[model samples]
Target chain A: MHIGRIDESATLGDSWLHQVSPISKLLAFALVLAAVVLSWNVLVIASITLVLTAVAVSARLKGRLAFSLSAYPALFALIFAFSAATSVLGGAVIVLKAVTAALGAVIVILTTPYPYVFAPLQRVVPGIVGDALLMTYRSLFLLIEKFGNLLTAARLRAGLHAGHPVRSARATTRALGGLLLYSFDLSQRSYDIMRMRGYEGRLRVTLPRSAAPLIDAALVGGALLLAATSLLWRVGWRDLNPYSWIVLAVAALGLAAAAASTWPARGRTS
Target chain B: MSHIHIPDGVLPFWLWAAGWAIALVMVGVAGRVAGRSEARRKVPLVGVVAALMIVSMSSEIVPIAYHVNLSVIGGILLGPALAVIAAFIVEAVLAMLGHGGVTVLGLNTMVIGAEMVLGWALFHAILKVIKPTRAGIGAGIATFLTLAVTTTLVVGIVWIGGGGEAAERETGALDPSTLRFENPFEEGLFEFGLFGDGHGDEDEDAEGERYLSVGRFALVVYTLGPVGWLLEALVTAGIIGYVARVRPRMVFEGALAEEMARIPGDETGGH
Candidate 1:
């Protein structure tokens, strides 16, 4: 909870947590989120949040990264309070569901690198698809940055620091117009860049022979297990959220397996 | 603002499966459309449209605390064929980014597709009637129509989904006579007078049996709906107005332009 310039040195190493496959973390997060959404038990939600917090700590995400990721749920919780006051009791459920799910996702993001995380999805989907997704993500941040630049340029050129609301509107609109032109030009240049790369209609990538088959099996098995468990929950296994406990057990087993594999090195690192 | 936040498995299996099916169908349609037309020629334009949709949806308006999403405006600007493809791709990609739900890709696509097609139709219909001189006015009017249509669809979906849940819960547990209104919050107002009714159904239903009433859910959905619309309208107006001023020909389909050219006073209105 300390504000301003918290240390991030803990995240510097290429430890086992950093080395774990992004796809694995993605699956774990999916399991926790699925469990949270299927059940209404506040206990399960809180427990899962705590569990994810532990994972976050283990992953070594601290300071700004930690705060920015976790603060979303709190923001939604504020909205939920207002919604609860105005409406039915359902708002609380919505908030809880959102928070737990977000916590699960945050754990994955904090544990994994951006490019490596997307690499698996890229392999599963096509190269063109991957390129498209990369473009989309890049474009969002690009738009923000470009918008800021446009505003700054407009201010400099027009010498309009602040003015009447109507004048301000005109200036803003003009800046917006410039942004549109810039965005379009950038998009065209991007298209040309893609063309030069021999992109064709699709992008293709060959997976590494090592671990690829095993990873594929694990992913398929995991998806099937999630689907099956969800169906089971629907068919009268109703309790105060049995799914989260199951997920917790599964997560514990996964960690145990990893720890066992690396038992000899644990004390050495610590 | 109007981002679909429901996680996978929160929805019924049927809902998720249906969404995936719809996504597949759209992909097929897009492929077919791309095959017939010069897709490579339009790739740059599609890229721009995709960028615009992403930017529009991500921009949040202050004080209102809502974000924008204008799949409808994309539909109007890009036309239904390309719009559907863009909407589907956008939702699927955003789902991975955690901005929307993965399972509801189909539903999100459907909702956005509806907005796009309807908005496109509405925008053209309004343009034909008003024939405004200023591109800003036309863009603004078109955006308003798009937002209006999309908002109506959202309200309709929320009401139907929420109403079904409330009815099912009530029939399974409560007295038949007690379930009067579709929305539980409005029902609360009726029963407790000021939400302090000693026998308010909320408390009674708060345990394992408790679920969100259609009315209560509606209140939240509606509360956020306008904010989403306003943000979307502003972004759309800004982008489209910019497009119209710089490249007006890009917006109108050749058919539309030809038809407008045939009409009286078209030259005066034409830029």
Candidate 2:
């Protein structure tokens, strides 16, 4: 039952996370993902997942963020159902790792809009490729809108109750065909507009204005600290694993993140 | 075509990384060959087609744990190069949406891109020689080849991922039969499944591994893959046939566009 866009209400709210630079969030997420992939310990992975979810909460994504986490486990639980008993633990670990990595990423996307996220890439890549990437990003939402409308219309035409499977499939294909033509027309018009503006393949993007380096640095450091702490706890493991120390540290970090996210700050009310 | 519905964190980092690297190369090549206008036109086309793929893949068929990938349709429309890039974008976005795993975006792209590339080549080749109107025949053959490649890819990846002595160390070594869940396929779905008489995997499998070994995985793929191919072939063929009749240029005269002027004296020069 999980449903929410990745960038839901990202630009509307004035959360401190929204003010943080997208690059900082991106770097932090990259670190979190690296930790999730490299670390095989279950407690450490679970703690990282909890820590990121807490950060998401701090970033004001609350239920939708939590919903995304649950979705991963729900999907893997089915695979666990069919696999042999020996593989269940391995599968569970994989599930935890996936949830942790994905939630960490959602934290970035949930806070930053497309403009900020792509601004860095737009600057780094060559003109044509960068512009193409930006164009694709812009067109995504438009396509999504049309797709939703077509689905609703198709459902209505089919009476939303009883349509043969074949008929329903046919309706879907027809809608997609319409979407295809619509997109082609849109592309032509967009190109026309591009030419009218005396445009080359270059698209200019505004950089972030509210650059809160301290707060952004703190967020990145917190994730890195957790990952480092987990890494530290994993060393000399062939002799004996110290799960308790890592667990206590992770719990403390998660709670602190949660409290900070919820704390009342300037220009904000809880 | 076959679609890898498996979530992330299962395949090793090396495998997924390789998948991403190869996919990136393919995208780069596509970009290099494309003209400015062609690439621009493809942006919106890819976006729209990607939306279609996501919608189709996200909707579950449930009974067989299968979903329509629509890679063949994307291939037919966008051709090989753009289809590969579009499929990668679509998979990456789906991964972000928590549909698939981000780690395996590379592998998923490869699988889907392979389907798209093969399907594209086959569709155009088949349509050029055959009556252009009978694109369904081309679509059907292309669909079969696409599925065959993708399914084999999935099986090979699983097998390679599970290889070596460290495999058992990777996962616990418990007897699978000792821990059994309720089998939903007791009566079989639409008379297709691994349940009827006592002639299931256990009867033929020698290793008797707890989870899916290479052999059992292959059997499952072979048994169920045809159904998917048949359905996709029918849909792809129908769509191509319809599009050819209404708008011939979109797909009809792709590989055989030059032949059009010679054979039918039609003058819609291929883009």
Candidate 3:
């Protein structure tokens, strides 16, 4: 439930939310997201994010998911800063609207875990097809990490020795070609492994029934109250951090703790 | 290309809602058919392609004021369903980053979705017929068409939102200014000054009606379409070419792979 770095174990809370159907979370997130985008008032945006933060904390989400979710607002703030510096016209208003809308959506994505989030889609989609799609989506994170590693490795080995345009061109071409070859081989091996595991014409997904009445009510009620309050505030607040700076300070401490815990054994292959 | 920045509180809620409805329907239809097929394996590649688009668009070529979006290539590489999802994430991130307006996310999604759908379908069909010696060219043409059609769609949507229908109604009237009526400002001294003098005169309406017709807006959009389309085409072609030359097998490994293998002339597709 902490707002610092995601702890992977943080989502182990006993809240009724983890029991809800992923479909409900999807619908909740999508609806709230649409509503937020339709609004321009800063207060409403802040209220929605605040409410979602409360729910996420209650869910006790731990790892990267929690950290990533909370980071959405900060990301928006960065964008706003850039736009304000460069833009001549209504930059301030536009930036605030973007931040608020984005924050509202992030709360939804963050509070609901990915596995739980995709559960509803499986039931609606039918069989292994949904499961396959979900698996495919998850695999991307691993694949990207691998690709980044390969690119880094390639950069290091290639060095900075190319002298002329001809050499530089050859080096660049070789590196790209090598990357493509590597990716193709990796994909083929993965596809073969998938086939070996009985992947076929359909993707199957199984979801356990989890949502309780209270959790459903809480999510719906919280979203509505936030939306109502936000609409009433119109557009007055301008400070980027709606929360006191102390909250950020606390979050920083938590991140430091999480990072330190993982540092000693980090990158140690099992 | 100046981002077509639609701020919040500009379009009515129903307009954005309509976009959501259409986007959902498109995703559903695309997902149902594509999800179970062999193409499903390629769907996750949408994320990689989306990342590529973000990097590509961020890197600008001189003389072209607009960043290269190349969403059409994404749609081509990973069909519409996955492409739509990719575009959604990219556009959402871009809007959140204030590269575009947040309120316009729905509209932007629809615009990018159109490019994916139209380009993918057309590219699929074209490759079937022309059977280009180089699969990369097929991808290039498909990307080009999608970008062109999607840009036109954007311009049309903008013109309509700008009150094209109202302008049409005021077309025959004497005053052109009536055709370009601005939405009243919610508050302030400028709002009062603009309307205050009790200037409820009908004669002024006649003069207002004479300017800025729906036809003029259409003309401007149509005129600019080609330039936008060409820029998109060149950028996409360049990127696809780079990908193909670097890793031809990756491009050849999808639904198109079998087709590439069967083609009489080529061996190994690429190095």
Best by DockQ: 1
Judged by whole-model lDDT over C-alpha atoms, candidate 1 comes out at: 0.52
Q: Any residue pairs clashing in model 2, and if so which? A: none
Candidate 1 falls in which docking quality class? Answer: incorrect
**Could you report the DockQ of all the candidates, in the order they appear?**
0.21, 0.13, 0.07
Which of the two candidates, 2 or 3, achieves a greater DockQ against the reference? Answer: 2
TM-score of chain B of 3: 0.69
TM-score of each: 0.70, 0.79, 0.58
**Model 1 bad stretches (over 4 Å):** A1-18, A73-90, A109-131, A155-170, A206-270, B5-13, B41-44, B70-73, B165-210, B219-224, B227-231, B254-271
Per-residue lDDT of candidate 2, residues B1-271 (tens digit): 3445554555555677788788777766765655444454445456556666775666655545567777887787777766776777667666655566667777888888888888888877777788876876788788877788888988888776655433323322122445432121111210122112323344232232333356655676677678877877776776666666656776754421322222322222222
Clashes of each: 4, 0, 31
Please provide, for model 3 over B1-271, each residue's C-alpha lDDT reduced to its tens digit, 9 standing for 90 to 100. 3133344433445565677567556556656655555553443344345544554444343332355566766676665566666666556545533245455666877888777767778766777876444565676677767766665676566555444345323211122334432322111101223213222333433333322233543564456556766766655555456665555543444423533343333323444
Query: Per-residue lDDT for B195 in model 3?
Result: 19
lDDT of 2 at A73: 37
Interface quality of candidate 3 as DockQ: 0.07
Residue B258 of model 2 has an lDDT of 22
Q: Comparing to the true complex, what docking class would candidate 3 get?
A: incorrect
Candidate 1, residues B188-222: lDDT per residue as tens digits? Answer: 22234322222435554533322334455457756
* Segments in model 3 whose C-alpha atoms lie over 4 Å from true places: A1-31, A34-38, A46-93, A122-133, A157-190, A200-216, A230-270, B1-11, B31-70, B78-109, B117-149, B162-185, B188-239, B242-271
> Interface Cα RMSD for candidate 3?
10.8
Q: RMSD in angstroms, candidate 1? A: 8.8
